[model samples]
Each structure stands twice: as C-alpha cells, then as structure tokens.
Target: MSKVRTCPACADGAAAGDSFCEGCGRTLPSDIRDASVENPDSVPTAPQVSLSGATPGPEHDGRPGLVPEDGPPTAPQVSLSGARTSGPDTLATQPMRRDSVPSASGGPSPSTETARSGGRTATSAPTVPAWPPPATGSVPVKPTNPDLCSWCPGRVRTGFCESCGRLQPRGRDHVEVCAPGAVGVSDRGLRHRRNEDALGVRVLPADAPHAPGAVVAVVCDGVSSSPRSDEASRVTAEAGVTVLAERVRRGEDPRRATGAAMTEAARAVAAIADSPGSAPACTFVSAVVRPDTGAVTVGWVGDSRAYWLSGGPSASASALLTRDDSWSEAMVQMGMLSREEAMRSANAHALVAWMGADSGQIDAHVSTVTPTGPGAVVLCTDGLWNYYPEAVDLAAAVPGAGAAPREAARRYVDLALGAGGKDNITVVVIPVPGGGGPRAGQA
Candidate 1:
C-alpha cells in the first residue's frame, strides 16, 4: 500500500491516489503514488525522442483519458509544430537539467535540488546599473574684447576687427607686468599701445659706494611679426642685464662680457625653438661701461642701434655703433650694391640676421670704443631711430640733457614718443666717465 503525503500548498494530508488537495483545492501530481514508492534520491527522467518515432504526450505517464500536462487542455494539438506555445515551449523545449534554472532575482534557491545525484553550482549574480548620475555643471569663463593690440591690449577676443584693424583683448590680465623695473614704464602718446616689448634694462652702478664705476645696460626689441614678442623682449632684457652685471662684478672685460651674454642669449633662443608650442623671436642690443677707464663695449643683433655721440658744441655726432647686421647692410657687404644704394633701397628694413633666426649663424656685432670727455652712449631700437634722422637732433632733444645718465635715458625716450611714436620705442643712455668729469671717490 502506498503511503500518504502532506500537500505543501494547503498543509493537508492526502492519500497517494488523490489528484487534488482536499484542504486548498490545489491540483496534485498524478504520479504521486509512483513517486512515493520510488527511492527519494531517484528523480523521474524526461522521455527521450528518436528520429523515427511517434510523438508522445504527457498523458502517456500512466493516466488514461486525462488532459496533457504540458499545456492548456483547450489548445489545438499539433504534432511537432514549429509554432511556439507559451507553457510547454518554455519548459519542454528548453535545454535539459545539465544546469539548474536560476531564481528570478538571481542564483538558485536553497530548496532547489540537483536533477543529477551530485553537488550543484551556485548561479552567477546579475549585473546592477550604476546609481546617481554624473554632475552636469560646467565652469564659466570670462569674456574678452575683440579689437585690442597684440602686444599690450587688455582682454582681446576676436583676433582682428574689420572696422579698425585692432585685435580683440583676450582677458582682463592680458597685459600684466610682473617683474622689477617693468612697472616704471610710462607710455607717451594716447594712441600708443603700451607693451612690455618696449621695455628694457639700463643698469648703471648705483651712486652707492659699494658698486662704484661699473655700469651695464640692455635694449631689446620685440619682433612685431610674431605673437608674444613682448614677453621675449622683456625676458631677454632682464636676463641679459643680470648676466652681464654679474660678469662686470667679476671684473671681466666689458667686450668679453658682451660676447658671453650674446652667446647666452643665443642659447635662450635655441631653447625657445626647442619648446613644443609657438615661440616669438626678438632682437637684443646691449652695452656695458667702465666709467673709470672711459671704456665702453657694445653687443647687438638686428636693427636696434648703439651710437657714440661726441664733439662738444662745435663737433658733429657720428654713429660709432650702428646696425651692424641687417638686410641693407648685407646687400652692401655682399657687394650686390653700394652702401648708399642699400641705404636708399626700399628693402632697408629687412633683417638679415637676428637673435632668434632658425637657420644661419647669429652674427653678434661686438665693438669697443673709448670716447673723449663729456660724450654720450645711445642704445635704441628702430622705433626711435626711425623718427630721428640726425644724431645731433637726438642728442639735443635727449632727456635730462646736462643732467645724470639715467635722466638722459628718460628724456631720449620721451622725445621719441613726442615725435609721433608710430612703432614701439626704447632708449638707453650712458654718459661716458671723465667726460662730465669723474664723480666723487672715483680715481
């Protein structure tokens, strides 16, 4: 006799032959009697199909005249129909018990028993979506102006304006001056754009007793053709002045110091060229003076000039040091034309050699001059020289005439601006020692 078993859904005890639970009206498996008789470890295996065989229905499982257990009883019965049905299509056609089906959330439940008589593996967990989306706020940038100058215009925006040819300013701090002596710059004309390019260093031994009789000065001109020319000029001026001053302190000859400084500047230019981004080139001209010996040494590249203005009231000023290397000078040197022809040529402004040329050797024009009493040393860029035709006129109008050297430098700059200052202007003046006569405490 078959034993009775409790129904899991209704908790009612039923005999092996019962097809429905008496307590909850739930349906029971027809094979319960056979299942109770078989060993608990042995499960019923699915029926296999052969290539040459008749189609079988779930009614074949010892229940005669009963509805097929695979799907709804009312559905049409078709043998091996390719069409999918909802129920048996999900269970019967699915892959057999090589692996257990995972629960809806993931992983098989603990109650699930392995179809085979061995241990079962835990199903893999489902992947979850990321929470809390990324932040959407973006950083805001300040707007810039469109019609400012490239050298010193504040906050330029549009590269160039159609109306006035002025470039737009990039940002509010585009024209900031951050170094010593940079703040001392004073723009002369209202129309003139103030730029660091026009700034330079003119070092003279302080009237202080400790560093007497030594003076060093530098003049740098920004290449108007390149962007950031102002920065290049400022850096070159400051670095060149500092290095030459240190050399002077070490008692090196001013001529040798000038050459060494140019060599250093050449290295700086090469470094700029080696950098990844855009770099602007510039021209450098410098002079150093030993007031005690009346000796002055000068070094220059490109058109920025140095001149020795001498001969008291009755004497005429001569250009002791002029633009040593330029297109016009090159034409004269190559004998392609006479010096007068080159001077009058329309291409006079062309530069043959400058401090930052990519190719061709840097031709540093180094010269030494010992002037007679009361002479002046003038170092300026083309901006000032372009306007002043005669050295006499420049000497006459130079700032602080008959005053100290520093004052004279300031006056010369002022005069250049007063003369319509179309381009960037710079000037440095050093009065020869023993000319105005030696200062107190000097030999």
Candidate 2:
C-alpha cells in the first residue's frame, strides 16, 4: 500500500505548520506547514555549456529555438537542461550533478510529454525556438471602484474623502492575488519609492478533478534605471498569464505556448514605449508545471528566477532553475572572468537583455524538469533573491508548500523587508500537487 509522507528527521507523518519534526524535534522547510526560511546547504547545479544553433543551444524541446543575429554567443553558453533543477547561483564553485549533461558538440534531446490520456498543457521548450509575435485578446482582472465616503459622498484618497478630508477607506500600495493552486503578492517594500514588480498565477482548467492542466506563474522586475519600468512589468505579467493560460487550456504544446506567450508579453510592453529608443524594460521569468508528471517548463529574460523546493521521505531534491542574463554570466561563460571576479564587478547584476521597445529581438531560454516528488515552483524578482544570495539561504527563507501559498508569498516579501528591502519585492508561489513518485534514478 502507498504510505503517507513521513518526516525525514523523525519518520513521523508530516503535519502542517510545525517548525520541527513532531517526533524528533528537527527543523523543516518553511511553508511545509507554516512560515519557513530554514537554510540548508545548497547544492550547486549549473554546468557551463555551449549551444551552437542559430539562437544558441537547447531549443524548447531541447533543440535550438531562435537563430541569433550575432551568430553564437561570444561567451560560453549555459544550455537548458531537460533534467530538473534551478541553475547554480554561485555557478563558479557549484559542482555539476551527475547526469551526463549534453556538451557543446551536440544539440540537446528535448521531450514532448503530453498530458496523460488527454490534451497537452505545458509552457516550455528545452531550447527556445524563434518566438513569433504575441497573439491578441487580453484578460483584464475585475476593476475596483472606490466607495463613496459615508459622511461626504466624495472620492476616497488615503482613507479620507478627497473633497471633505473625512476618513474614507484604507488602501494598500501593493497587490495581492489568491487562487486555488497558487498565490502571489507584490509589495513596494520599505526602500523602494514605488513597487515596480508584478506577478501573476493561474491553475489551468482541468478536464476533471483528478486531471488538471498545469499552473502558470510569472514574475517580472522593472529596471529601476528606466522610466515607467513598473508599468512595463504590470502589462507584461497580466498579458502573459492570460494568453499562456488560455493557450494551454486549448491543448497547445507547452513549448510553443510559452515561447509565443513570452513574445506576446514583450510586445505588450513595447506598445507602451511611445518610441522604440526610450522603451521601459523589465526582467521576466515564468514557469508552467503539470500536476500529473511533476513536469516543469521554464522561460525567462534578464534575472528574475525560479526554484524547486522538495524535502521529506520522498526527499527528491531542491534547486534553482533559470540563470541570469547578466554581464557576469556572460563573462563567466566566455572564460574572460571567474565567478568571483564577475560578481565583484560593478555591473555584475546588470541585465544584458530585457523586454522593451528599443531592445532588439529576445532569444528567450527554456528548460524542463520533472521532479518525482512533492515540491513548489517559486518565481520571484531580484528584490527577494538578492537578499538571499545562496540557494541554501533562499530555501530556508522561502515558506514551504504546507503554508497557504498567498500567505507564503507575503511572508517571503516580509523576509525581503526584514533583510533591508533594497528594491520592489514580488513573489509567486506555485504548489506542485502529487508527491512521492518513483525515485528519479539520477539528476
């Protein structure tokens, strides 16, 4: 008979929100039950690779996606992996997991795992293919209309009627979203003058209670240096989530769906640029996970990130998925600078590419991973990740799947604030349903 999940420390059935194992009093991954941020030793999981296809390496299905106008990247390429994991944050010192990751000489072998006995619903390709323009029809969230002041029937502003200065309604500078399978929260943070980050989450419509499509999560970070960057993030996230979710619902291939959706996100942002030269830009990172396969497809531009958090008797593994499109990453790839040197440089965190009007064609990177156990797919802007530099630290600080996802997101934002919130913080938490599958033989 199949057994329930047991704590790794005590072999006791796992309970919700307990910081320690019930039997042995051991620490646990936050969000497993309550708020969590316990740090574990991080395993470095990125290998330096080179993709030679027109666009670079791995395509959506692990083939080359787009043909780069500049030929191949002058720097060493970090191709997407079909295996499950987050890219190493401390890439230089991180050791490669043993999985015979493909090398520069060969194109990666990607997979197309359709939804079991039904229509398909994924949103990534192993290697990105050429991205076409975004298709139309935007989904708008319900609009909010201010309530009239009880005493003065005037517009409300900061809890006071604009006309009478009478207290009206309380408001928040941030946005909150809650869904059945996922939750997200965006905050301006203590340090930032305004919240410039945006997030979106959706659980795809399932054919039945037992079979669901997948969850789509997107988090975008506005470039502080650019004007109206926050607006850029908002439109990009909203449009991306709508199109991507609906596409999957229609049974499109995940690789094709995600690539087209991200491109559409770019176009949506570009429309706001008034002129191509002064376009506002933001970093985008998103993920789509199928409940049945524990399969994940990830896509991104710039440095926002995604993470897999797994623990317990199933004890699959946890990892960071997407790598940053920053100068340091490029330098590290080119062998022109070591990880330390690249990180220490003033431009280490500066993004090399982003979605904006002036920005040229974006060659988005996509990768897939199927964890054979229970976990959460985390998407966040740099605001949160910057504070937790190491994956171990991030794993500790992030709340686990046990906590309500929206609450977990808020708690994560709180963590960034506690760490001297340096920028806008946005977090989107996606719970991967179904835990404890057959052990994945090797990574």
Best by TM-score: 2
Candidate 1 lands at a TM-score of 0.52
Off by over 4 Å in 2: 1-172, 208-213, 436-443
In the range 1-443, model 1's lDDT, one tens digit per residue, is 22557667866554443443433435555564224322111121111121112232342232111111222211222211112232222322221111011001101111110010011222211111132211310111223332433333233334543443443322211121112111112222212233324333434334423234455667777553333455556566756776776676667766667777776765565455433223445677787666656555677766677665643532223333544345544555456766566555434444544554342343455665454445566777766676664454566565323235545554554555555444555665555534532321232
Tens digits of lDDT, candidate 2, 146-167: 5554334356555455775533
Per-model TM-score versus the true fold:
0.52, 0.62
Cα RMSD, each candidate: 45.0, 19.9
Winner by lDDT: 2
lDDT at 294, model 2: 58
Candidate 2: Cα lDDT at 301 = 78
